[model samples]
Target: MDYQPDGQTPYQNTHSQNMALASLILGTLALLTCGCIYFAVVCASLGIIFALLSKGGSLTMNTSGKIGLVLSSLGLAFTLLLYIGLFLYVLKTYGGFDGFMQESLNFYGVDSIEELYQMMGVPY
Candidate 1:
């Protein structure tokens, strides 16, 4: 048992504080920027790394570190799924923005975007 000079048990923080803080910061950034695909994944990965390191090679983990780990994992998964879904949607919409615009114009019976612009008398 651990006791302090005042005859009361004092709680000592033995967890890896630096790693926990890093994990939390990265996890938060990842969660906030989930739309950024590669960037979010990278941040979440770094957060997960720091969180695991905070465990200090033991079965026990600090509360903050565990929270950081969970947040990082969730952010990573969410961002990855978001990226993949957006990628597939882009593919379905067309190869690129130009193609998407062209397809939309075609659907409206317009032969080309240039012709539509010409009809509107808008300078290209």
Candidate 2:
């Protein structure tokens, strides 16, 4: 029942596990840097990619790598949800930057801030 070549079983490479661990760390960093929208999104994306790749690397069996993959996936999901929620809240509150700017301009009866300044003839 022993399936070993030359009476020595090959050891599993630890690189995949290390990659998964790194993915988890990056995911955690992304979650913490939620305020920086772009950075958080990018980090979360990379984390998810690394986790998936690690998971796909082997299916024979792995404990540490599996754990790292799971953690990284969860972290990625959490960060993605947080980013989506933040985006929705911003959209609902202000419509968007363009809408908010247009509203401001309409309120002042000006096409833009520049027009307002021109109307006032204030040297800038």
lDDT against the true structure, per candidate, is: 0.85, 0.67
- Model 1 residue runs over 4 Å out of place are 1-14, 95-124
State the lDDT of candidate 2 residue by residue for 6-113, as single tens digits: 867765443466667767776777767766767766776777677666655455424544554555466566667887897787788779868777887888899978
In model 2, what lDDT does residue 99 have? 76
Distance from true location, Cα of 30 in model 2, Å: 1.2
The TM-score values for the models, in the order shown, are: 0.64, 0.55
Query: Each candidate: RMSD to true structure?
Result: 6.3, 5.7
Candidate 1 TM-score, C-alpha based: 0.64
Question: In terms of TM-score, how similar is model 2 to the real structure?
Answer: 0.55
Best by lDDT: 1
Distance from true location, Cα of 44 in model 2, Å: 1.1
